[model samples]
Target chain A: MIRIDQLIKRYGALMAINGIDLHVPAGELFAYLGPNGAGKTTTIRILTGLTKLSSGRAALNGHDIEKETLAAKRQCGLVPQNINLDSELTVSENLDIHGRLFCMKPVARKAKINELLTYVDLHERSKSLVKQLSGGMKRRVMVARALMHSPRILFLDEPTVGLDPNIRRRIWSLIKKIQQDGTTIFLTTHYIEEAEFLADRVAFLDKGRIVAMDSPIKLIAGLGNWAIDWLTDDGMQTAYFPSRTAARESATAKENGFTLRRVNLEDAFLSLTGKKVQ
Target chain B: MMHGIIAVYLREMLILKRRLKRQLSGMAISPLLYLIAFGYAMGDAVQFNGHTYLEFLIPGLVAMGSMTQSFSIASDINVARFYWCIFEEFQAAPISNFAYVTGEVLSGMTRALLAIIVILALGLPFGVVLYYGPLFWLAAILNSFVFASLAVALAMLVKSHADQSLLTNFVITPMAFLGGTFFPVDRLPMWAQKILFLLPLTHASKAIRAVALSEIPDWRAYLVLPVTGVLIFIFALRSVKHARD
Candidate 1:
């Protein structure tokens, strides 16, 4: 559903998104994991037509982002990191404006707004001003607003950032449901667990480059099935083992405080990038 | 593209409607004060182009109202860009830069028209009525267009809300005063006239006042406004494209 080839984006002397290639197949939930300033959002911005690429080519469902901007844009929906809904406008009005921008007919717009509001569990608050809603409610409204036109690909840039764990789980379910409905999702997140639970494939991006890309289970399995962490003079040292028995054996041999646990997606990301997801 | 422009324009209209009472209060107070302080205080002592001072002042106020209100859109754009982040939402959509600029410029012109109506209505209570013929409407629209387009371009260029306010203080406020809105440009010293003559509002006020008084306006003003509006509108499109990228 999305193709990026040798994409390069520069801001004066600094390259925000350097030569990166990616392919997101239709109906796949792809999570992009990175720390702060890791070019994740920049890549999403370039794909969604929010920022122009300095070099190379990107396409959405076969439409080139630069030459066929409108066509490419029409195929994608982006829920930005920040809540960009018009605060003074009602929830219905916000969705209505988005629908109208995409040239949805009035009857179609009304129906879609109702359906999306319901889909996001925001039907009751449709009449309320966006500013009156809670953070989670506002985020839901943002999601509904982005889906008003029903684009083929959805770009979610930290859709659950700053939300509580419960709310994050709700958003994750909503994202899962969106993917199940045959929409390709390209999600950028700092939450490794979120990616692990939701993404079919995860890519670790650091310093404007992708260091690792694979299924979360595969990536974690490739590192090890289990890990042992122990205090050391340097700081903290961790060793990975293929099984819990081996990890337990390693932990028993240690003479300091140690922890034995299953290897997770975060460990895979850290092993590749050497930087923890923040 | 048209749908996107209309959508954006409608959003602004809805906001304006909801804020009508506050907006009308703000729009009415200044023109009322101008009428009281300048019109009543002068008391027919100041005459221009063979008309009463109140008659002369009303059209100038209309011209100035359109200029200020239209240019005021920059503040709204700055708010949306920095505070609301709504501009980025549009950028991520299928809307074109030209469509976005057109929508904003139309909204600014609409605000200018509403301000003109408020000023004209205020003039009625003071027993000042003037011709609002085709020329008057044309000049008002073109005047609004020029300032609205300029506002869009400047809004894109400014980095912060503080910078936006600074621009209004240094650029817009001076033009509001010296754009032949209150007096004839020729009445100023030759050097001042040369400087003020370069402003689009000078031509707008001259043209609007001519129509209000039923005199044949200088054809040069009629040419200057539409030409300036078109050019500034193109520049505004470029600014929107640059800012979005």
Candidate 2:
């Protein structure tokens, strides 16, 4: 549903996104994993038409973002990294305005707002001011507001960055539900577990370049089935093994105070970039 | 585009509805104080264009009130951009830049009109009355348009709330006093009149005061306002686009 070719974004002497390319098919959940300032947000902003590209061609469901901005924008809904609902407006009013911006009819807009509020389980707070909502409740409202227009693709940029673990899981389920309903989702995050649990195809971005891209199982399997960690004079060191028995055999607690565990997506990123996801 | 502009305008109206009491009180207090302090002090002593001081002050108040109230939209824009981050909501939506600008400018104009109504209503009990014809409305709307458009441009250019306040203190407050709202430009020294003549509000006051007194206003004043309004509106559009970059 989204296609980007040779995207290059520059800020004077610095290039934010340096010649990256991606394609997310319809109904696929694509996770873009990166550390801070790794061009993840900039890529999303370019795809959503909020930032202009220095040199690239991006299309949303066949509509060029630069040449056909309104059509391209209409194809996707965005939940930004921050909560941006109007504080004084009621929950319903916030959804109502989004509907209006998309030119939904009044009758249809009301119906859609009602449906989304219920979908996100915010129906009880429909009339409450956004400022009165808790952090989790506010995040749910943002989700509902983004879905008001029923766009084909949803771009969630760090949708659960600062939320509690429980709230983050709730949002994870909501994202899953959105994908199950046949809408393509492009999610960006620095949380390794979020990408591992949610994304169908994950891409690792470091310094404005894609270093790795594959399914969670494939990426982890390529590295190893288990990992052993121990502290050294330089820092922490980890070794990957193909089997649990092999991993246990490699970790000698008496020598270096080692620990053995299953390999995860973070190990893949660490192996490729030589840096932690955090 | 029209629907998107109306959507934005309706949102502003909803906010206006919620704060109606506070806004009405605010709009009422200042103009009433100006009338009481200036009117009773120079009731019979001053004669402007052969009318009593209160009569002359009422229309000038209308001009000044409209300018200030209309330009006050900058505060709202700043709050949206800085605190709420609501501009990103519009940016991600399918709304056009022109639609957003037109919507905000019209909302500002509506606020100015409401302030004009309050001043006019306040004028009645004091027995201060004047003629309000089509020309009067034309002048009022054009005056509101000029300031509202300028407010949008300045709102986009400023970085912080402190910067916004600095703009109000240095630009808007100075224009309010010297724009022929409190005294006639002709009454100022020749050098001051020459500088004040360059102010768009000066032409607005000249045209509004003339029409309020039932005189045929200088056509040049009418021409200057709409032309200036269009130019500023264009500038506001460009400013908004640049801000997005």
Clashing pairs in 1: none
Q: Report clashes for each candidate as comma-separated counts.
A: 0, 0
Over the true interface residues, superposed, what is the Cα RMSD of model 2? 0.9
Off by over 4 Å in 2: A253-256
DockQ of candidate 1 relative to the true structure: 0.82
Give the least accurate 10-residue stretch of model 1 chain B, judged by summed lDDT.
B44-53
Report lDDT per candidate: 0.91, 0.91
Candidate 2 lDDT, B164-193, residue by residue in tens: 999999988898888988888898899999
Residue B185 in model 2: shift from native, Å? 0.3
Grade the docking of candidate 2: high
Q: What is the TM-score of chain B in candidate 2?
A: 0.98
Model 2 C-alpha lDDT per residue in residues A102-168, reported as the tens digit of each score = 9999999999988999999989899999999999899889888889899999999999999899999
Q: How many steric overlaps does candidate 2 have?
A: 0
